[model samples]
Target: MRRRLSIVLTLLTVMMLGVIVTGLSFGEPGAAPMDDYFIENSQSESGANNVVTAVLFDYRGLDTLGEAAVLFTAALGTTLIFRRRRDD
Candidate 1:
């Protein structure tokens, strides 16, 4: 009985995962909506030669920096957790 239950649960979990993956939103691989003014203004306002660079590195710099910080913090946490504890 226990073995049958385990197999049923495993199959159910696999089917659920397949359903979720199949329902995911994966549209055209690469596309952009760039009105020329939006790009030109973004470049000049953010003070970078490239508009995309300005948008990513200037306007969104804080978010990028935060992502880096979070990654660093997670890595540090994981390392500390797995590291050998000192007894001395």
Candidate 2:
């Protein structure tokens, strides 16, 4: 029963993944107007030479900080998990 359930869940996961991939593959590829606006004005607005840096650090600063915090927490958790177990 356990093995059958595992197999069913695995098949469902693969089917869901295939459907997601197929849906994404059919998306229209084009430059959005917002992207063009950002490219044209990012340097002047943010005073950053690199547009990507300007957008990430200036426009999306809070989101970037949150991502960094999450990464730091993950690293700390991994380090703790892998630390030597001292036999007391």
Candidate 3:
């Protein structure tokens, strides 16, 4: 049983290593058209000098807000859980 388990684990490890090597060899992906659009119009449309800032704050404001809300909720929950309760 132990020998079979060891063999199975070794084979899985080798397979995973081969997959990683293959993925790395593919290199960087080609840029999408949306990337070019953002680069060209972010400044004019969003009125933000920085492309990244424009995308996060103007173009994708709602998505960014949702993410912030989730993070804030998580932080509040964590604080509530760890806070001390006063027993009078």
Tell me the whole-model lDDT of each prediction, alpha carbons only. Answer: 0.83, 0.91, 0.92
TM-score, candidate 3, is 0.64
Sort the predicted structures by TM-score, highest score first.
Answer: 2, 3, 1
lDDT (C-alpha) at residue 56 in model 3: 97
Top model number, TM-score: 2
The ten-residue window of minimal lDDT in model 1 covers: 29-38
Candidate 1 residue lDDT tens string, 1-88: 9999989999999999999999999656335455455576886687788777887788789998999999999999999988998899
Which window of ten consecutive residues has the lowest lDDT sum in model 3?
23-32
Off by over 4 Å in 2: 1-30
The runs of at least 3 residues in candidate 3 whose Cα sits more than 4 Å from the true structure, single-residue gaps closed, are: 1-30
- Candidate 3, residues 1-88, lDDT tens digits: the string is 9999989999999999999988884435535788889999999998999999999999899999999999999999999998999999
Which candidate wins on lDDT? 3
Residues 1-88, candidate 2: write the lDDT tens digits: 9999989999999999999988874434545677887889999999999989999999999999999999999999999998999899
